[model samples]
Target: MNARLRRIVTSAMALSLAVPLAACGEEQTDAGAGEKTIGLLLPENKAARYENFDYRIISRRIATLCLECELDYRNAKSAVDTQKMQFEGLVKKGVKVIILDPVDAQAAKSWVNSAAKKGVKVIAYDRLAEGDVAAYVSYDNESVGRLQGQGIATALGSQASTANVVMMNGSPTDPNAPSFKKGAHGVLDRKVQKIVSENDIPDWSPAEAKKKMTEVINALGPEGFDAVYSANDGMAGGIAEALKSAGIRNVPLGGQDAELPALQRIIRGTQSFTIYKEVRPEAETAAEIAFRLLEGKSIKSLTSTTADSASKSGIPAKLFSAEIVTRKNLKDTVVQDGVVRVDLLCTKDLATACKSLDLN
Candidate 1:
């Protein structure tokens, strides 16, 4: 056998001999080649998960399955051009496969096509890039919007009938923003009095969200808003800060991504609800699928459905569910799944609140 083929055989045997790694009731291992390299291109450092969870878990899994397999990692820092350059570099490095969370879906299509031409398989890691891809793994993102809306409406309760809220949306640059807005608006549109004002913030920045919230609060006069649907937790903090400065009390707030302070605010009754996307399963599952394709194995069991992007059709997709955590189900949702480290969320400051949720 050729050296590369022999290496593949040896690595496959070693991986088969090891127990499939498990977290949150699923198993994953490298299936195909023994000692091949994979490239992982993440979008930015602005979102904490890209570095903290995604990088660590994907690297660990590759190490467990094939000790010699290297991960050529890069962070685009939210630059589309930089990502394209990185993707080209990975292709030049002769990586067997690439897993990418794109900086911009539509802008990255050319790179995806170029890599395909060179015979390097591409997996759309978290964000779906616009192209024919090997596979995709993410949560029910639209459903998350619906949940956030419901959470706000529920928190508003009787007030929803007359509630005038503003929306602080994610970056306009992200394709997901429109879908998330669509989902939230679907529920909120029917019940709420009106959207007093709204803007799609650029780059999903907390600073920008805060600035927007302040501007809206001032423009709307001192009567203030009944609630705000800040797309993610970081931006939610921004809205909350604006609200507090204006002395708006007992107002419902909507958020997602379950950043720690947001959940704590839910406990403190400072914020209403946050959506938990639970990245571990999505990250691990994507890594496993990439490994399978490298090993020349089928991934039918992992993917029972599909996703359609503007540039691709019949893409094998794994869509997981999302949960809306009020102060009520914090334990039942994120904590129950072991998605977040309790020690981190349930610190000395939030210790009582964590026990209140029965998380420990």
Candidate 2:
């Protein structure tokens, strides 16, 4: 194996082993009496990770911690009003704690206040919801953006000095988007020749990203931009389709959320890299926090430190580090963790690519 590949594999393995070990070392307790209910509110269904990974892992962890703990699940489906209704319903159900990945971070402030009034404890999950909450759990988001930027810069190498880049960012309403954009700009501003265009994708919608990409393509033409900074894997696919429609190939795109299609693109050399924040550990951490809150156990010892939200500061939080997933670490990271099963990743069309990577 090449030195670069070997180094990546070792790093990935080390990081992979560290996650579960750290989680196992954390304090855990069994659920007791009164059949407490915990509400889980996810932002939207557009991102495959929410349903395929986040929900499953969180549900499994919650179940493991508390067999009889009632889970009230709801998907906002990208509607702020829908999420508001769901939040209200969860509060009405008198859930002990609500784990929310809000549809609109700013708008959700009112909802958080409402929940607080009703004596419901909220754990902001994945996406940090504004206003007072008991805890926050997510990957270090700004670092996610920095990794995306650094990946694009590294892919272009010396060409980065003169490379015109386009940034297709996530939902303006998402609290994380600003952090992602800020982190990316911190790197790209110093490296790139010029940012040809940058857009905030409302709702983090793939269709919106595609539409914005198409607009960018029309303005910049096929060869105008050297790379694209896609905020997440969902938007990365749309950006890829836009580039393909314009007959632009292999433009060194970067994404987060190591979704299957993004990894496939990395293998085929369409996308340069993606950030993999292991959702299992993130979910498990959130579950641990929720259980402790419900059981009236102190969480001061488990969390790294407190986080500052728009409405409030010093909110307790558990933040996980993210790994940049390139072709080099594909086997050692996602594949090794079974985030995406080999059978699923190695589809008929991706079979040859999978074998080339020794993923078969």
Give each model a TM-score.
0.86, 0.89
* Candidate 1 off by > 4 Å: 1-35, 339-343, 346-360
Clashing residue pairs, candidate 2? Answer: none
In terms of lDDT, the best-performing candidate is 2
lDDT of 1 by residue, 1-360 (tens): 344554453344334334333221211234332137788888989767777677767766766666666667788998888888877776766676889898888888888888788777888876788876888888777888889889889999988989998998888767678878999999999989999998998878888898999899889975767889989988889888988898887888888887778877987788999988866668778878878887888988888799889888989999988888888888666555554567877778778877777866
Superposition error at 158 for model 1 (Å): 1.8
Stretches off by above 4 angstroms in model 2 are 1-35
Ten contiguous residues with the weakest lDDT in model 2: 19-28
Candidate 2's residue-wise lDDT over 1-360, tens digit each? 355664564354344332221111211233332238777889889878787667766776677688767666778898999889878766665666989999888898988988788677899998889877889998788888888889999999989999999999988889999999999999999999999999999877788899999999999898889999999988988999999898898789999988889998998888999998877678878988899899999988768888898789999888888989998889988887667778988889888888989997
